[model samples]
Target: MPVHRPGTARREHHAAGVLLAVLSALALLLTLPGAAQSADGENVPPRGSARMGQGVLEHDGQGGEPRGGDAVQTEGVDVSSHQGNVNWSALWSSGVRWAYVKATEATSYRNPYFAQQYNGSYNIGMIRGTYHFATPDTSSGAAQANYFVDNGGAWSRDGKTLPGALDIEWNPYGAACFGKSPSAMVSWIRDFLTTYKARTGRDAVIYTATSWWKQCTGNYSGFGSTNPLWIARYDVSPGELPAGWGFHTMWQYTSSGPIVGDHNKFNGAYDRIQALANG
Candidate 1:
């Protein structure tokens, strides 16, 4: 065997050590879950930053104030069984003009309070709509969308009924992206929107955080101008929207508001909002 110099062996060993370190770091980054990697790797701000009982603010960069500067906007609330026995009349009297009720979740779970919240808000002279909480891991989007419409997503020519909304946010059960690839999530959303529109004759609104949308759906913007965007961010200006949307349709600014659940701001005036409800 050829004899090697001691200094050369030391240099080689050092190089190998550096290489192993680099590989380990790369592996760790690859294994880390795709969280909010928006601009500054900070989007999807914390929930209920400006609330009474909500916890410490997350301060993610994804959320912000409503758009449409100088234009008068409408305030609304979104609720489900989480907020038990809502007082819709009091909310209306408090200047809340609209509501989005959680109607269904995944494929099997339906909100028991959907009828009461939906009809209650409408009866109190508030524009009301139903939203489906997407559980992509549990079932296909089309199936979930059908279940939503069958339960409470169907809208009528009644001027106060807004189109159904697709609530695609964090994965409550499993992986953050529901263990699906970005392309898979985009496909699921398309399936849900396609089926929803076909059944209801109206486009479904999409509610998501900026970073969550980017991470989960690869920032999919295929819905174009049809599906309205409802961006969820607490205590910050929605710095950037997802692809294909310059402004948001509604902004869910907080979770614990005057009436509980989520507090929302429609981007346009009451007339424009009425126009949206009509469709």
Candidate 2:
């Protein structure tokens, strides 16, 4: 028979209690919304939740741009899962004529709120489309594009669904350019654009910032001629466009809007938005 030491059982009980408390706390964190558990049991930011212009506002400070002035532009907003069940009717009543909802990120995740946001906007009579956040480091662009289309980035000729957009901006996770060289970045973009076009039969809009375009793609001019540009600049006049694009099709002028965080302006009038949708 072994003799028990004084206070040994009490110390063991105290240690067990501390361990249980720590585990319970971890479990609570994992169950919290927007926190996802990876295969390795690590808590990570929810996949497919990266929003359009997420890094723009952080990288480039907002600039002054008069809203609804003499400029004949259409008001629009872009949203992701972060916006969760947006109030489309309020936006429509506020003169927002178009919207873009995020569909996927890389090839791993899809927006869980895609249906509510995508269909709700259309039902409210707003010309709407979906966008995919590019994570060039995770997978090939073609694979991400296919995942986007398979998820919710598909297009239709209903005159209400605009073609999907590829959001190739600053990488929010790790490297600014996802650790790819300029030429490699350009090739990745080309792969994504080509795949998206092949899958949907429409030229996908390229959403990026001038600085990012110049830095990551070495200011590649080839995409300008084919892909419609959705320039992200909070400046007064969209600052400067990327190489080869004479004009921007859409300009995200502000990340702080009346109702939504990301607001944009279609370069032309409402009819242009319709025309873009028609295509």
Residue by residue across 83-172, what tens digits does model 2's lDDT show? 899999999999999999999999888888889999999999999999999999999999999999999999999999999999999876
Task: Assess the local accuracy of residue 275 in candidate 1 as a C-alpha lDDT between 0 and 100.
Answer: 97
Compared with the true structure, all predictions reach lDDT values of: 0.78, 0.89
Task: Return the TM-score for each candidate structure.
Answer: 0.76, 0.84
Best by lDDT: 2
CA lDDT of 27 in candidate 1?
66
lDDT of 2 at 120: 94
Task: Give the least accurate 10-residue stretch of model 1, judged by summed lDDT.
Answer: 47-56
Q: Which stretches of candidate 2 lie over 4 Å from their true place?
A: 1-46, 67-69
Give RMSD to native, each candidate.
Answer: 11.0, 4.7
Candidate 1 versus truth, CA RMSD in Å, comes to 11.0
Q: Give each model's clash number.
A: 8, 0
